[model samples]
Target: MINDLPIRKIIHVDMDAFYASVAQMDNPDLKGKPIAVGGGGTRGVVSAASYEARKFGVKSAMSGRLAIKLCPELIFVKTDFERYTEISKRIRNIFFDYTELVEPLSLDEAYLDVTENKLGFPSASLIAEEIRQRIFREVGLTASAGISINKFIAKVACDYNKPNGQHTVNPEDVLQFLADLDIRKFYGVGKVTAEKMYLKGIFTGKDLKAKSLDYLEDHFGKSGSYYYHVVRGIHNSEVRPNRIRKSLAAERTFNENLSSEIFMLEKLEHIAEEVSKRLHKNNVSGKTITLKIKYSDFTLQTRSKTLAYFVRDKAIILETAKDLLYQNTLNNSVRLLGISMSNLNTKPQKTEPLKENTVSVQLQFKF
Candidate 1:
């Protein structure tokens, strides 16, 4: 069956320390220094850290306070989405020069289907190399590329040689490559899922392939089927261009934990307002509202409720969020709060109801 499938030339391109690298590129003074792009306050989270800062253990999504503790000389810069967005557009233009089938995962990374490219390039490796070189020459930022027969392997390969590097997995090497991969590194297997897989004696692709499809399904639900196929080097998901935005969210971590319900409600109002603005900007409305709460200890909880009709108004969003919040007991002092809207689009797709306590997981394509 594997031999029967047509081999695709997929390339996943990822920017090296995108935001941090952009900062350094635009300002020569910041080059070769430890810098983090985000607020410097104790409650702030690092959006991106330069490779120099990473050497000292600083990372994205980490608290600024902890990042400072790890790298005392770390420099913090506020995020400039406008600049990044413009740069991303230029990179996408570079991709379009090769193939029209480009799927952007974020401002910094994308997947390109170059089986038949406009440039008439026969070697995917050469195309990837040329793309990386062009990005460096034109955009003044380095990018890494991964070439393979499918999105899953291509994305995984991109990470193998990161920070201005490229890696390729030929069709013939796909199975062997997957066999040696750590389960933790597999797409869609998060920390919780990996721990579960470990306890079930599935530590690598080889171990995962040993499990029966029925067994995997029984243990991991719908996602088990995904695992079963992906382990066999059978990912068939395509590179969908211009995929619609499924959700819009806004979140913030307070400098001091908020214990009072009134304060939490006030924060929710602000978050809902931001979400509403984003929804309006996108010209979309959603039927479901989700409120995310993070405790001071870092334990997380989410509550969601789907409405009968789609809404994009700040009043509606704030009211729905308040209901979701008040219904749940605030068992811990909340350190972070967030709200998101999903089930977007007026014409809804007939789908199964989202399971309780389950957050929609975006497939791990973007690093």
Candidate 2:
């Protein structure tokens, strides 16, 4: 079957409590203590939590305030983006050495396509083990890996085992694993969607597969088509080596066209505001701002400007977008307005603070 099927070997790699582990690795005294990353302050949220802290019900995305309530001994540290990025680059280089098909989900996670690789290994599991060992020996970090024939199953398999563990799901087991899995565990089924599916009596893959495509589309819209593919273990999403963004924009199309300039400016301001918010959240500032306009007759035109410096401020985005809008003629009635930012500036350097650990959290089993 492996020889007959169009099989491709994929591996998912994830760092274990990456930020907290890196901090502990650097400081010996904090070895066994319950530690968290990204929130010592009242308002900050926990970005990562060690297994020890997780035992107390502390998890990522929970507010530091609540995390402390769960475990009073929890230690929190601010995020050091630079250190993490540096480690990420090192890991990425290692992946490229074997193959160029590396798709990073984040700094802490990635999927590597090794079906045709430089190492010429017979099994992907062997390659995964080599990658994990390389990360530990070279980067002073522990990484978990999952080996499978595709991204969907591979990603789920990686989480099966905890820190420094590896798992595999062959082609034969893919369907059975997906069939018995909780609907919540399926990719793209978040908390809200999971609740909705449960309400519809779709608790497992089999439950979901039992429904007709038309029925799913009627209830869940386009997601129904997506679910159809995943439940059958047939995902065609590719591992992009380098994904680049040409433009990032948000737009609104009103059902009715208006001639009032004030209302038009207000709508543009709102779109610009959202674009600015997203830009700052990604820590990217753009030098180019473009405005898109659509007339009631379906005629469209765009105007753009290149700025001297990168900016992601709401006021700046609005001011620039307004200027571009005015530069173009508003001959016909307007139906839609869009704003986009591009030509990103250099990323900010992140510095991790080094702390002296007064308490040592030791692994009872020993390293």
Candidate 3:
């Protein structure tokens, strides 16, 4: 329990086209062009696409075929998960220099709590600028930052000015900014919920605030309480450091159906390599390997394998995933393939004692 609340300072940092930008940075020819990284075959899925591709209605998660159809000249490159994961670590190290209260949402997005920074800085925006400069200089990637009183506002502010931009939302301005915001802009409201709100005449935060909590509860159930508080600029989620991940998985939905087993194996290898890289970076190992396949008709099936000991080796991961894939021979042509590792040993020990055949144990997992 922490008392004596000081002025809250939070910042959200998001990389612009993180995956695609990394690809573009490495290959100058890709710059300013419609480029995507992921599976390349007709059955390949896009892991990330540049903003230029987005202009042509190309988006991540759209089947690779649909993306190419939307942008005839779209360039598809294989994903380099190893490279992106390395850069993510470098950026994270930069965050630790100012404050340890960092919560990474993914490789490209994170929230920093700098209410009490080591540098004794008074303004969070200054710290944000320095971090952005460091990322560009050190990692060779551009990052946009948002500074605010809390995570929610900061995240929204970051998106407001994207592609290497920064914005700060003060406590005093929270209400005005949120007032005109569409109800859909609220974090938890999805397309379905937004449509529901629209039908109920809830167009903006002001309209949302007019409804009673009981009324919202009747419609949205438990999440309604969250909507009520968020509209009033009241959120209480703390920034935690080094949070452990329970599972790591990567999946791709191809643009076209794939009948060739060899092509599907190549895609799985890529996903497996990425999942393994993430596991190794976190110093975590998994005992379970899961392989998922989706057919042209959208039917999905999953297979899993459990190991006796935790492992993080990429070769082992790929081998296990390959075995799982072979076990579940596809009845229908595969449209999507995914490799995931879970049931991880949340705690990892660096050194193993040779005292006994069973080997000594060390508590390395940090909560």
Candidate 4:
């Protein structure tokens, strides 16, 4: 077992079906009925699905047509970002009551480092319980929490008892807890990565923990070390209240300006690759793709497209960048080409760990 485990008490707080719940709370008529926010038309995609809708196979990102087919009575409600933002602020203010180390991953979820809290409480589980209780009473919504020694473990645990529940993993139980976890449930494994791991006979945390770091590196490349460490519950990332990125970009200035569409596409492919790597490294996705073109004469032009959903994959980013490139003809030979992504999903949910000296936490936990 890892020695002298970090004393930090981390709690992950996730609102239950946030958008759908807010819709229901705002419109009592929608309560207890299957409803979906967004994706109202044939070509639309759902942004959020209520718990009732989820039971019928409706989910966020599913086509509206399919959601209707699964639950014919499903009601569609337009998304109200202003209202969502309003409620998110209320929830965040509640968090500040306990600790300032709050890292918001999205409007619906956040990570809190309550190692030393305003309440002078040593038991993170108790703090989580009180926080959830407060959210319900003060905000008229439910929140789930997972309390543990670090961010990743807390993130995974919070999902265990979802929709108005919580789970706590003590320091001593961290390793075994990870060992028994399904690889698919591991954060950041994603669908494509999970399929690759399955093909390699890496189906669970135990299976992944058996693979050498070099083996993971050979297969997963940039993401290999992430898999190697998380399986051991080694995430040491600290919460940053202001950790955010407004935009991410990658650019290239040609040694020689070229006017050919083929050459521009080649340069765009490379730029997209770099942007995609940065997106993955930061654990973020973006809905807006912008292509910046600099003419040989130094005049600048930018074309942008904003999608309805977030994208982080290289192929999709490249395709969007290509579409923007073709949207207009070259006014002049391009001296510099750049690709940037904005309107990102939110904060970085996962990151590599850092080393620290041995620190101790209180023994008694009021779970």
Worst 10 residues of 3 by lDDT: 358-367
Model 4 vs. true fold: TM = 0.73
Superposition TM-score, candidate 2 onto the true structure: 0.70
Model 4 over residues 211-271: C-alpha lDDT tens digits?
A: 9999999999978998888777677678888887989999876767879889888888899
Tens digits of per-residue lDDT, candidate 2, 1-367, equal 1232346789999999888888888787777899899766765678899888999999998978999999999988767888888988998888887888999988999999998889777788888989999999999899999887678889988988968999997766777788898898887999999999989999998898889889888998999887887787777676776555555688876756868777889898899889988887777788999999988787989899999998889899999888887785687989888999988875434445422111112112100
lDDT for each residue of candidate 3 in 1-367, tens digit (9 for 90 to 100): 1222343689999999999999999999999999988747766678889999999988887878899989999999888878998989999999999998999999999999998888988778889999999999998899999887667778888887888989987765777777888887788899999999999999999999899999999999999998887777666666767666888888877767898888888898888888888887778888999988888888989999999999888889889888887885688898888888889887633444322111012122110
- List lDDT for all candidates, in order: 0.89, 0.82, 0.83, 0.89
Question: Cα deviation in Å at residue 295, candidate 1?
Answer: 3.2
Better of 1 and 3 by TM-score: 1
TM-score computed on alpha carbons, candidate 3: 0.77
Candidates sorted on TM-score, descending: 1, 3, 4, 2
Off by over 4 Å in 1: 2-5, 346-367
Q: Give Cα distance to truth, residue 23, candidate 2, Å.
A: 0.9
In Å, residue 234's CA in model 2 sits off its true spot by: 0.9
Question: Any residue pairs clashing in model 1, and if so which?
Answer: none
Query: Runs in model 4 with CA error above 4 Å?
Result: 1-5, 246-353, 356-367
Cα shift from native, residue 46, model 4 (Å):
0.2
